[model samples]
Target chain A: MRSHQTVVDSRLRRRRTAETVFRFFLLASVILVSLILSIIVVSILWKSLPALKLSMIFKTPGTGYYLGKRGGILNAIVGSIEISFGATLIALMIALPIVIYLNTYLKKKSFLSEIIRLFLDVLWGIPSIVYGVFGFLLMLMCHLRASLLAGMLTIALVELPILSRAMDETIRLVPNELKEASYSLGATRWQTARHVVLRQALPGLITSTLIALGRGLGDGASVLFTAGYTDRITTSLLQPVATLPLAIFFQLNSPFPEVQQRAFASAAILTLLILFISLLTRFLGRKLSRHRIK
Target chain B: MDKGRVLKKEKGRLVAAGLISFFPIFLTIAIFLLLLIKAFPLLSLKSLPDLIFSSAWQPQKGQFGLWPFILGTIWVTATAFILAAPLSILTALYISDYASVRLKKWLAPVLDLLAGLPSVIYGMWGTLLIVPLVGKFLAPLFGTYSSGYSILTAGIVLAVMILPTIVNVSVEVLSAVPAELKEAALSLGATRFEVVRYVVLKKSLSGVAAACVLGLSRAFGETIAVLMVVGNVPVAPVSLFSPAYPLPALLANNYGEMLSIPGYESALNLAAIILLLIVIIFSLVARLYLARLSRRRDR
Candidate 1:
């Protein structure tokens, strides 16, 4: 009996020790993520300080800046904004309809919706580079050269799955009873979706669109070949345009120290843009959650 | 007339919805077809085994072997999964089982932000911070020459980039474990940790596995960031510190120039096809596993 009791005690002690170690491990992991985030922010800022000027936001990238003269990445900034906006608009137009159709046209557990979702998942899992390759192929097929329109089309493809998935989740949360109520009031499915579903999911839809926008703006690989880089900003969709990520990639690859500093500055700008979008989405998400029908 | 108008409107709406719904399916098939069509030229250029197993990638000499790139991609992605899996699962567990409501709220957005951040920024961060640290500090300890751009640096950056995906999916899985199940475990004299370990983790094992699969898919497909810090070497890496090239990186780095050389376009297209196939398989497996996990939970 004494030995049995000792064995039990040892087992209990071992289990307790394991629990403690696991708890510490969990805490360390969380802390490590937070630490990396702060480090990324701090290091980018530190490195970018030499070239991040208020004037940089206004001036176009001067040619031969790799020779260590003055310039800004405004051209890339404007180009990024144009491409992202165009892509997000296009994605929203397609995604909103698809998500609405998925939720409304099909039964809640419809196999069609399941299959559609699986397709989107596959598309979502495809790498940005593959999308770029596809875009490049499309460009070739059409006998079209690289341009902003090509980039927008490629990014639209990339953002479609993300936005649609998000909107689908939110639309699923719209109470079935509310749709029933709309239908009982003699509303058509299209009217019900427009009036009840869209109204209810407006906040979430906005947030999802913004998230997709952020993705479209920040993606480099998808646009690398499709949107051939240019030194100057072009308003025309036919013209190739530069973007912050490609600019940073190009500048970072240069042998010049000043060009490298500019890469850091571009990094800072890109980070700030994404951070702004993220914070906005978070704030909107919180607000929507508070208003959500539990 | 009024009833006819209503019927016509309904038909129009349904048709519109059906057309839109078909778009994703159409797009998926189209992408596959496009890849296959463009990559067909390589079929005559080299045999399948020779193309994939040969190690030399001299474009000028028309030698397009993919074995080295495959090896490098596997090494970087496997190392990233190793580094990210434990941390991500633990963080997910903490958030789901241990965190307060307020903390959960705070953490969710940050993870979302991390998930949404661009891959290029990750590459930039890898270049600016990880590479230098590896070159100046870590490489010496590993007995490798310092260039800051190696398989290890790329793996570390990919690890960070993949963490949010794993954590988010794992949290969703753990959260789906019914509250009563956890309560019962606690009532049976299990400590909080014990309940989490035996009850939550066990129940969510498949879901966590699914999350890891998704993360692997992401790591495999990631391009510019991995391209930036991976040193772009075409040879297979012998060690973590050695410079290597991944499939996506190779595709991205060479696709532009591929058009200029004979048979190069077909080679790059084959690489993209390989990447697409691997990522698609991983994603489908993940989706299936997650579906099974949820079904089991529901039962």
Candidate 2:
């Protein structure tokens, strides 16, 4: 009896020690992840503080900006916004309808929906560099030069899968009873979709749009060859556009400290824009969920 | 007249939506076909073995071996997976099994934000921090010389980028492990950790594998962040400290100037095709696996 009790006590102690070690390991991993995230944000902010100025957001780069001359990143800021918004608009036009069709018109677990979802998933996984290559090919075939129009179309393709999938998941969450109620009122499928499904999914739709927009804004590879960065901002769709991502890439590559500083500044602006969009998504998602019927 | 016209209008709308829905499939096919067609010249010019096995990459001399980039991608991706898998699994376990309700709620959006941050931002951070740390500290510690831009730096950056992806999917899979099984294990006098390790991990093993595969696919295709920090040397990486060039980086760096060299454009296209194939295979396999896992669980 004494020997058995000692064995049990030792086993219990070993198990307790093992449990404590495992718990600590998990806690440390979480802390490490949070630390990494904070480091990214803080480092970017710290690096950009010296070079970031309000004028950078309001003025275009002047002559010899790459040589560490005085200038601003207005061209990049405006161009990033324009390209992303245009791409989001295009992606939304196609994505919203497809999502609506999938959720309302198709039967649950239908073959077509399954295949479409798979295709979107694959597309979403395709690298931006592949999209860049595809976009370049399309441009060549069309005899189009690198321009804002080219950038917008390319980014729209990139955003399409992401936007549609996000919207699809959101629309799928709308309770079936709500849709049935609309149908029982003798509403046509289109009316039910337009009024009921769309309204219920508005928050998600907006959130997905912003998400796609943020993605579009941050992508540099797709526009590396297709967008053809320029110093001055041009309103024409045909003109090559400066974008924040490309701006950072090009400036960082320069063998000049001041220019590298500007790159950090561009990075800061891009990060801020993405951060704002993310916060807006959370805020709007909660605020708009109030009217949503679960 | 009213009912007939209304029905006809609804039918028309359905047809339109259906056609629009086909766009994804069509786009997928188009991308594949276009890449194949563009890559055909290079595929025909060089024998498959020579192209894939040879490391010679002189564009001016019509040499376009892809072994270096392929090997680089493998090295970087493998390192990333090594570093990320354990951390992500542990983080997921913590989130699902250990975190309080309030902590879980806060962590969700935080992870999402991390997921949604632009790859360029990660690249920038990697360039500023990871590169310096590797070159200044890590290289000396290992008694090696590095230029700060190396495969290891890229891997560390990529590991951070893919952490959220693996963790999110894993949390979902971990959470799906039935509470009853955990409770049963607890009643047997098992510790929470033991229950999680024995019951939850056993049940969700396949799902977690699928999640890691998904993260691998993301790491494979990530270009900008990897491109920024990965020393884009055309040589195959022999060590963690060696400069490496990945396929996506190869295409991103060269496609702009490929018009000047004969067969260069085709070689770059072939690289893109290779990248697309790898990413598609990994993603489809993982998605199908997860889909089947969920179906089986439901049953």
Candidate 3:
């Protein structure tokens, strides 16, 4: 009896030690990932701060921007905003209808919805560079030059899946009882979707659109071939436009240290835009959730 | 009430909505068609197998072999998976099974932020940080001339970029493990780790598999970040320290200049088609597995 008890106690001790060690190992990995992210953000800020001039934020890229001369990424910044906003609007037009169709037209477990979801998933996973290639092909077929319009169209393709999926997920979460109530009141499917469901899914729709816009703004690959970079700011959709991501890419590739610093500054600005959009979603999501029916 | 007019309007709305919804399906088909049409030149450039099998990628000579790019992509993606999978799984386990409530809350927002970060930012980080670090430290150990731009550097950056996807998905999977299941395991005198290892993991295996597949898909499709640091050499990687060119990098770097050459556009389009098909397949598989998981939950 004494020997059996001692054996059991030793085994328990071993197991306990194993558990403790394993737990700490897992914790360490998690911490390491977070630390890496923090390090990246901090290093970007550090590299960017010294080069971030007040004039750089507002002035357009000059001829010698790549040669470490004085200029700003304002051309790129305006182009980024113009194209992303255009893309967001384009994606919203297509995505909102699809999301509405998914919720209103199809039953929850329908095979058709499943197929559509799979299609969206596939699109969502496509590399942005592939979209760039496709956009280039489209440009060839149309005999169109690389322009802001092409960038907007390509970004719309990139943003479509993400925004649609987000909206679909949120719309799917609307309580069944609400829809049933609308039906009992003799409302048509379109009416329910337009009036009741739209009201409920508004915040989510805005959040998803902003998120997609933010993604489009930051993507460099999709615009690489479609939007030829320009030094001066142009509002014409037909004209070639510079964008922040491309600006960062070009400047970083420069051998000059000052140009590299400017690259970091552009990156810092891009990151700030994304972070701001994120914070907006969180704030808006919380405030709007109060009005959401449980 | 004019019931006929109301019915007519409802039918019109339904038709409009249905047509609009058809846009995604139409877009998918159009893209596939367009890709094939654009790549037909390469496909008919002898045979598909010859183009893919040959090792050289000289567009000028009309010898458009993609084996090196394919191999580079596979090597970098595989290396990234090897580096990321264990760390992500462990992190997911910890978050789902061991972390306190407060820790979970804190971790969630951090992961969200990481996920929301742009790939361009990641590329800049990799270029400024990982590439130099590799040249200064890692390459010398491998006895390679340290250019700092290699498959390994890109792999490390890719691993970091995909971590949030893996961890977030795995956390969702593990969290979906029923509380009752864990309680039953504990009641039977199983240790905490044992319960998690046997019960929680077993239940969430499919979901975890989906997470890994999705992460792999994301890593494979990523372009700019990998392009910035992967050296852009059009050769198969013989070692981690060797420069390599993945397909996306090849497309991004050469598409502009290649367009001026005959048959080059077709070759790049072929590469893009290959990328699209592989990514789509991986995503479909992941979604299929996730669908099974959700159905199981419903049951």
Candidate 4:
């Protein structure tokens, strides 16, 4: 009896040890991920602090900027805002309508909606470089040069699936009962979508737009070929535009230390902008959710 | 007359929505066809197998063998998956099962921030920190030398870039597992860990697999970050320490200056097509699998 009890005790001890080890690993992984995030933020900030200046945001890169001359990244900053904003606006116009149609006009889990969702999923997974290539081809076909218009079109394709899917999920969250109430009031489908669904999904729509904007703002590959970079600020949709991601890429690739330092500064600025947008998303999501009905 | 006007407006809105909804489908088809048409010239020059399997990549000399790049992409993506899959899965498990409410709230925004950061920033960070650490410390410890811009360095950076996707999806999947199932295991004298292991993980196995596949797809097509740190060598990588070039990098680097060369544009377009095909296939498979899994569960 004593031997059997000892055997049971040993088995229990083994199980207990296994559980402890497993939990330890789980905790370690969480800490490791958090540590990596902090490391990325801290290291970028550390390298960029010495080179970052207030004037960098206001002035355009002058001649000999790549040779370590004095200048700013205003051209890139302005161009990035223009291209991403243009893309987001274009994506929203299409995405909002499609999302509303899917959620309200069609039955839940209809075959057509399923197929559309599948296509969006695949589109979301396509690499930005592919879009760049496609955009280049489209430009050739249209006899258009590498310009801000081309960049906006390419980035719009990138943002479309993201915006549609995000809005689709959010619009799905609106209760059927709400739509039914609108219908009982003799409202048409469009009126119900505009008044009932759109009102309830306003916060989600804003959040989705912000997310797509962030994506477009940060993406470098899709614009690499389509948005030919220029030192001067873009004055027209037909002219080439500079962007922050390309600024970072070109600066880092330079053989000069000062140029590389500017690269770090550019990265810092982009990271901070994206970080602000992310936090704003969370804050806005919460503030807007107060108006949502459950 | 007012009611008639309202009806007419509704009809117009429906027609507009229907047409706009087809735009994405039309765009997808156009992209694929354009790539195929552009890539056709290269296929006429060389067989598909030769184009894909040949190791020589001198664009100036008219050779466009993509074997080295194909292998390089496979190596870096596999390394990233190996490094990230476990960490993300465990992180998801911890967040869902072990993290306190306060910790969960704090972690959400942190993960979102991580996810939102651009690839260029990740690449810059890798170049500044990871590249030197590998070139100086890890390589020497392993009795080798590297310039810190190697496949391993790229893999490490890419792994971190993809962490948020895997973890977020897995957490969603794990949280969806019935709480009652976990409680039942606990009531039957199983420890919390065992209950999670036997019940939660078992039930959510397909979902976790889908999350990993999604992460893999993201890692596969990531361009700028991988290009920045991946040494951009055209040779196939033999070891983790070797510099390599990936397909996206190849497409991005060669598009502008070399269009004057014969067949160069077509070759680059073919590379883009290959990337598109791979990413599309993987994501579709994962989505379909998840759909099937959920359908089964619902029944």
Report iRMS values in order: 1.1, 0.9, 1.2, 0.7
How do all the candidates rank in terms of DockQ, highest first? 4, 2, 1, 3
Residues A1-294 of candidate 1 have per-residue lDDT tens digits of 579889989999998998899889989999999888778778888989888997678888676777767778889999999999999999988998899889988887889998998888888888889999999999989988899999999999999999998899888889999999999999889889999888888888989999999999999999999999887878899999999899999999999998888899998999899999999987887787676555
**Model 3: residues with Cα > 4 Å off, grouped in runs:** B1-6
Instruction: Give residue B177's error in model 2 in angstroms.
Output: 1.3
Model with the higher TM-score, candidate 1 or 2: 2
Candidate 1 chain B minimal-lDDT segment of 10 residues: B254-263
For model 2, residues A1-294, the per-residue Cα lDDT tens digits are 579989999999999999999999999999999999989999999999999988788889888878988789999999999999999999998998899889999898999999989999989989888998999899989999999999999999999999998899899888899899999999988989999999998999889888898889998889988999888886999999988998998888899999999999999999989999989989998898888877
When summed lDDT is taken over every stretch of 10 residues in candidate 2 chain A, the lowest stretch is A62-71
Question: Scored by CA lDDT, what does every candidate get?
Answer: 0.89, 0.92, 0.88, 0.92
Q: Report the lDDT of model 2 for residue A163.
A: 94
Per-residue C-alpha lDDT of model 2 across residues B1-299, encoded as one tens digit per residue: 49999999999999999999999999999999999999898888778788889999998899999999999999999999999999999999999999999999889888988998888889999999999999999999999999999999999999999999999999999999989999999999999989988999999998999999999999998898999999899997899999999999998888877767888888888888888999899989998999899888889
DockQ of 3: 0.76
The candidates score, on chain A by TM-score, as follows: 0.95, 0.98, 0.97, 0.98
List the lowest-lDDT window of 10 residues for candidate 3 chain B: B256-265
Q: On residues B16-105, what C-alpha lDDT tens digit does candidate 4 reach at each position?
A: 998899888888999999999988998998999999999998988999998898898899999999999999999999999989999999
lDDT of 3 by residue, B171-228 (tens): 9899999999999999999888889889998889879989999999999999999999
2 or 3, greater by DockQ: 2
